[model samples]
Target: MRHLCLLVLLAASLAAADPIYVTAFRDPCRAIEVHRLVLANEPVVPLTVVVGGVERQVPAVSVALPRTDWVVHRALVDGLAPATEVTLRFPGTTERVRTLPADLARPLRIATGGDTMHKPEWLAATAKALSARDPDFVVLGGDLAYEDGKNGARVVTWIQTWVASARAPDGRLLPFVSCIGNHEVQGSYGGDITKAPYFYAMLPLGGSATHAIDIGDEVSVILLDSAHTTPIPGPQTAWLAEQLSKRAKRPSIIPIYHYPAWPTVKVSKGEKDPTGNRVSKLIREHWVPLFEAAGVRVVLENDQHTYKRTVPLKGGQPDPGGITYLGDGAWGVDVRRIFPGLTWLAKGAEVRHGYILDIHAGGRIAVTAVDETGKDFDSVDIPAR
Candidate 1:
């Protein structure tokens, strides 16, 4: 009788949980199938794809979620042309997912921003402005939720905000890729992966703390962990070197991390806490060289809560034959002052804004910083090398 009562309670609890489902950014991407899926309370849900008036059920592998009612599944659905519209159906809902450019000959618009600390007004306004641009995808720099992803219910609200804000003008959901920042963890640093339960549970980036995602043949985004969960100059550095070495021949190699390698507004250099200095040192000593050698034309960064652009430099000096660092994420937060007396610093802005990157063929790129009111405050153009 006791066992029966417990079973009934469990079933009732799961039944009461709200239904939530969202798509994740492709990690081990094939450029053909949507490999990431998040479905709550629906295990082994059917995914139907419609193409040319033909509907077929796709096979999916359900991943086990411990201690939660949410179910995650991955499906392999291919054979669709790029830019072609296709309808995907689940148990109770249907959505349209756009395919990549058929020939990879045109430009790719990407929205880049971060530091959304649970401010609903800023989030909604910025999201609304971002969707108007019709970006192909979004890359966030970190500090996703003000709750630090420690509270379960708060994390749920954050996820709901993220998903709701991801709708484009065409009504298609845009894919979001992010790097873990200090706010994602409870203590902000020196904690294991378990410290960020909601981050790991919600965004599955190939089960690795650091990973890279290639967006067609034009660009490869190498996402690094800036001492949040993993240390710099250690295992993640080795992996970054390997990934960059292999993709060196590609047209563009861009790196995006939570902490800016060259911060615009900090005088301490993290001497109080050794972790901060260590992260800065490791990035400067180990990773920057690799990026320079690999022809990384640009680097995206955040964590300073301001807008900044560095002069093109080679080996940390102002040189035309070097990479341009654009960053200091200003999403849902107030801006801070830029540190003075830095020769490498080209331009800096203290404003609440985000960036829109227009990547064109032959390695030509343009970045624009736009505030929450949909105003373009600054713009930079990096010509083809």
Candidate 2:
């Protein structure tokens, strides 16, 4: 009778624990898939979560983790409505996940800023500016840090400033993607693939299985190695051609690289830096002809530390339907004269610190160039596809 009385009291006490609850996924850009429901306040029980009434286990997520930062684990559920609020519940919690509005009638107000990351404080400000705009996905068009041949530890420190310290006013982590930059190349010009260890380690975004996430596809994004470890010939070259050819049919295609084919500033070309090395050579001679032939839309170039939008040209002459090349990356760095305008440039950037980008969505494309002050320096509305 004494034991029975004790059992009854224990059962009553256990039923009173709070339901474990918190936001599961914050990324508006990630494909609608199952994501691990992590605790904002870590708990001890290794709690349980149920999506659509199917129970799933909660995994350990720690802010203290640097290498595994931004990773979701264990559970993955799919087939979700975009930009909709969904519910999730755990024994002690329940939180509402509101997906980003999937139906963005206009260009998905995306903000593109790069190079604001060389200094830690600058990244904080960059994060602040981005948090205010809350772009669909932030594009780090490279040169995020000035490691100058540093170790991964430096990356962790820099990431804390560039990524961790960043938060939306609503308390969301601004997820950004990367393209290779000159600063990322260890030698500042040429280095082996291994030298760029930290770059790939941080952003493992290349997906070979899924075309959308693949390095090159419709809406293809070709990340060039520059003259870094991977030369523009051989496999990289073959792959580049394959990607460009594929981009011909896609809605939009963009190419990103560390250097320029039509350099805004005069830098000594490497003796070994063939036309292929410059990218303009093969890209123009081999690839551009194909791009023009196929209809590749944009080629994003950097390294001049300035902003420029090259006229759409075919064989060096202005061709209205040719292709547009924008950039001369000057994100966190200072700049020279390469003006930003519809016509102020083959190269005219008298200002510094800006990011150039295209907003791709809803069968419509728009280009907007934002200066460091977060002002729209120039924009063009590309007609819907």
Q: Please name the candidate that would achieve the greatest lDDT relative to the true structure.
A: 1
Off by over 4 Å in 1: 1-44, 59-81, 269-276
Cα lDDT of candidate 1 equals 0.71
Lowest-scoring 10 consecutive residues by lDDT in candidate 2?
Answer: 208-217
What is the lDDT, from 0 to 100, of the residue 196 in candidate 1?
A: 71
TM-score of each: 0.84, 0.67
Name the TM-score of candidate 1: 0.84
Off by more than 4 A, model 2: 1-105, 151-153, 164-170, 205-218, 269-282, 337-347, 355-364, 383-385
Instruction: Give me the overall lDDT of model 2.
Output: 0.50
lDDT (CA) per prediction:
0.71, 0.50
Candidate 1 — worst ten consecutive residues by lDDT sum? 27-36
Please list the Cα RMSD from the true structure of every candidate, rounded to 1 decimal place: 4.8, 9.9
Best by TM-score: 1
